[model samples]
Target: MGRNTRKRRSPLATKVVAGAAALAVGGGGLVWANFYASAHESDSSHHRTRSAGAQVATIQCPDVGQKLRNVPRGARPGVDKELARLDEQITEAYARLASTRQAQSGDSAYVQNAILGPLKSKRTAALDRIGINIRRGGGDAPGGLDRFAECRGMGADQPGNGDGDGDNGNGNGGQDQDNGQGQDGGQDGGGQDDGQNQGDNGNGAAGPFADDFVDINDVQPNSRDLENGLAANGDGGSTGSFTAVCGVNENNLFNSDNLIVAPGVDNGAHHTHDYVGNQNNNAFSSDDDLAGADTSCQNQGDKSTYYWPVLRLQDGTQEFDANDLGGGAEGNVGKILKATEAEIKFVGNQQSDVVAMPKFLRIITGDAKAFTNGVANANSSFSCTGFEDRQVTDKYVLCPEGSQVVRTSNFQSCWDGQNIDSANHRDHVAFVQQDGSCANGFQAIPQLQVRLVYDVPAPTVENGQVQNPYAVDGFPEQLHKPITDHNDFINVMDENLMNEVVDCINGGEDCQ
Candidate 1:
């Protein structure tokens, strides 16, 4: 059942094309061109498998290439060490373009014009040695050196009023200004085309986190994006029939050091992970770099290693430090794209029979010390939109009229079919049969779902501080309150899409 489509472009379009080199050339692997959207194949012969969030159908728009003149009029003392070695050569050319998913390979256009085009003229000649004011499009316009659309909140468009901050007031720049009359209609500057966000599938209209903060690709599932598929329960609940989407690449979810935890130690997981598909991972990484890395996950050898833990929104009095990194240090905070979009559903018995999912598995969903420990780890979900039954630590939750603001996580699908790699990473794995099937000895797999969206109402001081309109990158600095939000996954699935998710749960078929 794979028929679905929606396309839209021109959000600052940029193209380069050309792919298929299979990368991994120098070593740290990263190929390219591996996209899959839908496929059902299962005509009795048995041995098909592949229907759990099969996404990656075109999500381009990150070229931020040319745009940096000559500016060397003021303090140029090695301009912060040449913008920290061009931020480690543009995060190693986006980790070799996320290990060759090929969006213009040839080493990602030679690291985007030989290392992000002269590191975008030494980051505007070191922000013109202080004095602030690069203003081309405002919102801290770094363009040329391409901060990758500032992790896709869309580098300062300013006016969407969804409130991430873009109209130049500076809480970090805003753009998604709604008009469809949703989040109390509109805020910031209720007009048209200032930062560009009117409506008609453009987001900024139809409000309230409009189907996952709109960059638009076919997010028509309104009602708060199906409000957790209407509380999908277990058994024959069919759990919204099936859902699977994973078109990510927002700078591999906050990068700088490359996660190594032991062997020589890199940044390790000291806070920072949204990752998605394999790029070689960090916290020390292994299994032969997950069998020679390179994946955004379309079966390309399924080099496992998906990640989590990077949500921290509380700009009420300042708490959004997604890695900072203007001059380096303070967590570097660069890569941006995920305004909220990564789904995968299948809670119970869409069919059930499951198996094939044992390759270095290490899933851990939610509770990263749930705000210093609170216990409740059953699948894990936090709410605040009409008080979906209430559960708060208050990182900034006002919600009232029509309600909105949520963070959901659900993994742990009772595996044990074998062993991938586990010590304490979560006892082998278990938890499914609540009608979803498996239990007893344990088997069933595939059930990711990691929803996150926020509209944030109340609190926006500005100069005096207090900003937080829902942000996340890697929490620490006193845990930004909000019960220390959490999430983590690592089941490099791709032994034929984990045997087509065990033939779509033993052939009950209902794919995405």
Candidate 2:
């Protein structure tokens, strides 16, 4: 077992959070350094080729680059080798489809294919859970750009929230009341400061994402920061989070187009519980306060992707685990990790100090940072406070020192905010933005990866498996659904670029 972490014994107060902050400590502040929390995992490991819900050590994830506290890296990191391994597994899956087909008579075979055409089919169910995509034919070529677009969708092109005469309160340009910087146009507000988080063992090992694009010698892959955001830590439970450090940019060492989305179905994938089981103490101890929470939150996909991924310094210094900080739902930008479908409360299951955001379409080449500072560092739009415990989403700019942006939240969106709840914050979409934090000469916007404190709910079958949409006459599983624009208003994706069977039942318009 690794050395256990202690929640207390810390220092370097960044900002004095209210008593109700989600990860709140007693002293009206978020400890920035000297945080030692001893955490224990009670679950035992099982063998015999586990499926999605298996208790395994940090073994399944592929390493990107992991080392102990700034130690130099070896010739290869784990991620590269795993990608190669994944390629082999996916290929084998394709071959399995053919062999399985041989064992059946014409009708049985036809029935089998008709029933389980895609990886989601009963016949191929096991294969899909193991990260394999076995369709009637095969997957699209790896890293195919157009296909990638179909899955991730363009950011700026997305239609605004459909409310009223285009003036319904969807985040728009109205000088959004800059507290420090603007809302990054993409990011929401509600957050805090960090000092003890990454400064733990020096090397400034805080978050899972590192800024090696500038130095390349500063990457640290293995550390506490990396361990927390991983699924292996969940003891086979579905709450663990994944972070990955792919070569999104050669010069910057970040991904500009990366996205991660949460499934909204109750008990959907990436389910989690938020802010559960925390005693109000005056001191801040990282005692897994958010663990065991009775809530979870799921959001729209393709916004930003933040899995716990590790990195190695160009100088060869090792850091956190490769899979510990970075690795998640196959880069789909919509797969779930830490979420509970039914109740939409956000949880803290992921590990890492600062939630890192990439400059839009541009990864950081140097000084990779999560920016525009201030209370914007907190998650969601609100925090909790007081004996009655009212929640408030206090939007403040860390860089400005004064409140430039000041937006509050209703309980409908967030749970609470900015109060002395000691492990209490609201559960809502982010409300802050990044202004002037982009890397020079990159893309039009900033790409982001947040190290979420996942507290997800268990995964549930959608529609009780009432229908297997993948089954169709004369259609490949990959070609079942056609992403047609609905009267140029609502639209859906084609199967080759889709995951679930489109609910063509209602045409999705819910006409009043």
Candidate 3:
């Protein structure tokens, strides 16, 4: 895809909320899986992680008595003029913030404090002035532009965004680590301050990890392989069951200065992701990067960035055990590894043809916010001892004796055949039907699935406390909390493999 084509996007008709610049991806630690659909159909079967009926705080501007300006509802001529002027002022203020001193790539607080902080104050003041102007002009909210004020710093997941009803999960507010580590290499380390790696405190928390630490071997055991339940979807492509083994692309795995979450927001992921296939991929990594980065794929041209949160394991002993990675500074999560293979599979859609995904299109599956938001669109599965069939949600299942634990995620595969992205990032794609056929107007694409198998040891109980052997990377210090993890894929497939995938799906032939 050319840069010019990628750059063509609709302008923001309404002002985004203030503090938007600081809204990191997975901000508050809850990944905002902002997938979209024209209309969200609430399925009773696939429940969310949180109570669907939970109430979310409504974001609004300073009350201007009886009327909130509605941007969609145009204002009176005079009121419109004033609103336009204020919009310009707000835009200018944001520009000023952008021009402020630039912080180091991973310095999280620099943007929040120096840029967003001051910009918020200025915007809030300007909004307040707008209210005064509206009053002076003898108008009520000048077409609900007043409501835009409520969106200040709020994400698309928040309420009053004209989207469907669903509260963004509650994200825990803490500090960011400059050295990118906490006590003893734990996340949000709350115990003894045996300071190791320390980073610029983003949210003013002492560090990412606490004083206490748990070895990977010490974590409590969860699910394991079930007898006869661990079978792969046999008979492969005849029924749309297949696997695409994207080989290990070591060069693609690195500490990214760019945050993959909010590309516009610097260091938006806040934490680093283990990237594969694309060495130059990062937040703010442009079409140029996508077009230019080296690929570890056999094609030698595919640069799609496949990334996920970092995983950290304990070291040999206390003398070496650390929770840091990404440069392994003291107080940092240590030792990132490249997966031997990222096995993307297609299950359920046995009869659908795999269409080629558009270049530069971004798609995310699963919900990182699932933990706090209740399980929605969850396709997480687990296995042990090479058995791949067991799947469960919510609680982790203890594996059978002698089996290692594993996690699997399957992404939605039906596409609209038109738009590569939508407002919510999900509307453009739909899941295949029970028979594995795409809905009318949607095309079948290679169903992408990911499986992560860890080398965690057996669980042990110490002094009545159960230590699970495996936990996801980037979680808080607590062990085995039901986590909401997700995956992201930007299509940079080389034309050869892309065509082969399409043929496999269309011809009803399965191959690894």
lDDT (tens digit, per residue) of candidate 1 on 183-242: 322221121212332111121111112211211122222323222212323455333334
Query: What TM-score would you give candidate 3 relative to the actual structure?
Result: 0.53
Q: Which candidate do you rate higher for lDDT, 2 or 3? A: 3
Q: Which stretches of candidate 2 lie over 4 Å from their true place?
A: 1-370, 373-512
Candidate 1 clashes: the total is 52
The sequence of per-residue lDDT tens digits that candidate 3 reaches over residues 1-512 is 00111121113212322222232221121111111111123445533222121111111122221123232222233333333333333333332322231231224344455444554565455556655555655555355443434323221122122221122111111111111111222212122212321211221111222222233232324433211112212243334445555564544344423333345332223234666667666544677778787765554656666677544333212212132111111112333444544666654345534668887777766444332232333335445544444344333335556665566665667778876654335656766554555566777676666777655544443331233222344312111122345577888776876676666656666655
Lowest summed lDDT across 10 adjacent residues in model 2 is found at 481-490
Give the deviation of candidate 1 from the true structure as CA RMSD: 22.2
Q: Global lDDT of each model?
A: 0.36, 0.17, 0.40
The prediction achieving the highest TM-score against the true structure is 3
Write the residue-wise lDDT of candidate 2 on 1-512 in tens digits.
11111222112111111111222122211122321111121223411221211111000111111101121122112222222232222222222322222232223233224322331232122223222221212332122211111110011112212110111111222322222122322111100112123211122221111110011112122211212111111222113222222212111122111111111111111111112112111122122322222211121221121211111111112211111101111111111222111111111111111121221111111000011111222112211111112111212111112212111111111111221111001111122222211122221111122222212121111211111111000000011011100000001112221122111101221110
Per-prediction TM-score: 0.31, 0.18, 0.53
Error of 1 at 234 (Å): 4.7
User: What's the C-alpha lDDT at position 344 in model 1?
Assistant: 49
